[model samples]
Target: MRHRIKNSLALVGSIAVQTFRGDAPAGAAMPRFMERLKAIGRAQDVLTGDGEVSAQLRELVERALEPHRGGDCRRFRIEGPDLRLPEASATALAMALHELATNALKYGALSRDDGCVVVRWWVQADGSGGELRIEWREQGGPPVVSPARRGFGSGLVERALAAELHGRCVIAFEPAGVVCEIRAPLPRVAG
Candidate 1:
């Protein structure tokens, strides 16, 4: 319990310290930050108490986006194989998704009524077990513009998630919307 509490505090503190507080008012940012914390909680909720085990990837993605659905479920489309991910990887991916979704709500697709996001994943046969690839693409939103500075959110989504999953993550800011692609080697001994 103590360890978990410490970790939870550290994670929260890290985000507060690392997040880029722009010219936006606290009122506008508070809800987004709260949503992010809720996403982290949902991610942790999926972890089995047992030693490093697995959980459904689809579930994690759904829960991360649940708070953003507002009234219409049609805003987000999630399509992926029924695969399980290790607890750590699952948590990392969930966090990344939360960040992506928060950004969308504030500046991208979810900001517009007609915009939507697609979450898709697939597995490729590698020499070993296989490789998992997850894609997050937004469409029909405001014109996408890359941030002038790479914020901590991008670092967490790209570098932190890649490290946790032992894979690569790339986020693209196209004119249409934002796209995030992540690829990682499937753990040899999956749960």
Candidate 2:
């Protein structure tokens, strides 16, 4: 428990340092940073709830996307079996989901009237808890083109989340839309 709190604080501190050191305009950076912090806080709420160090994967996804969803049920297709994630994996995955949903709203599926997103996950059981597989797919959006350089959100989702959860994240910008695939071991211990 002590280690979980320490590590979580360390990760949050790292995020704060990186956020302020970036080149974003002063007006834009603070709001974005606060949103990220809020996303983290939502994940922490699940992690610390009722003496359970694990959280429902579905609930985490919903909370992460809550700000961007705006009560539009038709734009999202979130489905998966009930699976519980360890604290570190839950936090990292939630942050990654929040970034993806924000980007989708601003520039991808959620930006268009005809577009939609689907989020699905499943678990593969193992002796060391299990392995989690999640997919985020966008459809009917504008033609996709890969960015010339990875941005902060990309770095956070692909690199930081991977390190924090000891996992792998791959994002593909297909002409049809954007797809993000995440796979991680379900370690009971906090990373």
Candidate 3:
């Protein structure tokens, strides 16, 4: 019974991670799970410990996602309000940004002394909700080709994040370099 309970708890936690954030496997109902978790957490926090605990939970969630923040990204220039996001969503965003920066730092713009990167974002109203506009531009890098298949970096930039955030990720390869843009939703609670 003890082992069964532990296993059940573990499964619940896993489901929460998969639903509230894109911390689950591919081909799953990514956004549905995230929405479910967000709604459940909001309800849970309403009656139990609220403000402080919610903030702390958000931080803990972000920390848990640190490992996924991998890539060859370099310098970044981010602009806009730091809206409070759920720990899980925040973690996903951080992971996405970190991956971009890491990739730039390694094989992309930051690879050369003459090369550099710019990261920027902004918040805008969208109908009833809001949207976040983010851009990552790489300069002084070699030419690039849109891969026939999504590479690891592409998967994170295009698929994982876009699916979870309900946004669009566009990558443009110019003779000068690569420029990537993302437009994702910013929920009221997240801000």
Using lDDT as the measure, what is the rank order of every candidate, best first?
1, 2, 3
lDDT leader: 1
Q: What is the TM-score of each candidate against the true structure?
A: 0.86, 0.89, 0.57
Q: Stretches of candidate 3 above 4 Å error?
A: 1-74
Clashing pairs in 1: none
| Candidate 2 whole-model C-alpha lDDT, 0 to 1 | 0.84
Best TM-score among the predictions, by candidate number = 2
Cα lDDT of model 3 by residue, 34-84, tens digit: 543444344234223444212332333233223323442333333445555
Native-to-model Cα distance after best TM-score fit, residue 101 in candidate 3, in Å: 2.3
**lDDT per residue (tens digit) for residues 115-136 in model 1:** 9999999998888888999999
Clashes of each: 0, 0, 16
- For each of the candidates, the C-alpha root-mean-square deviation to the true structure, in angstroms, is 2.8, 2.6, 9.8
Cα deviation of 115, candidate 3, in Å: 1.6
* lDDT of residue 165 for candidate 3: 68
Off by over 4 Å in 2: 124-130, 189-191
lDDT for residue 60 in candidate 2, whole number 0-100: 84
Q: Provide the global lDDT of candidate 3 against the true structure.
A: 0.54
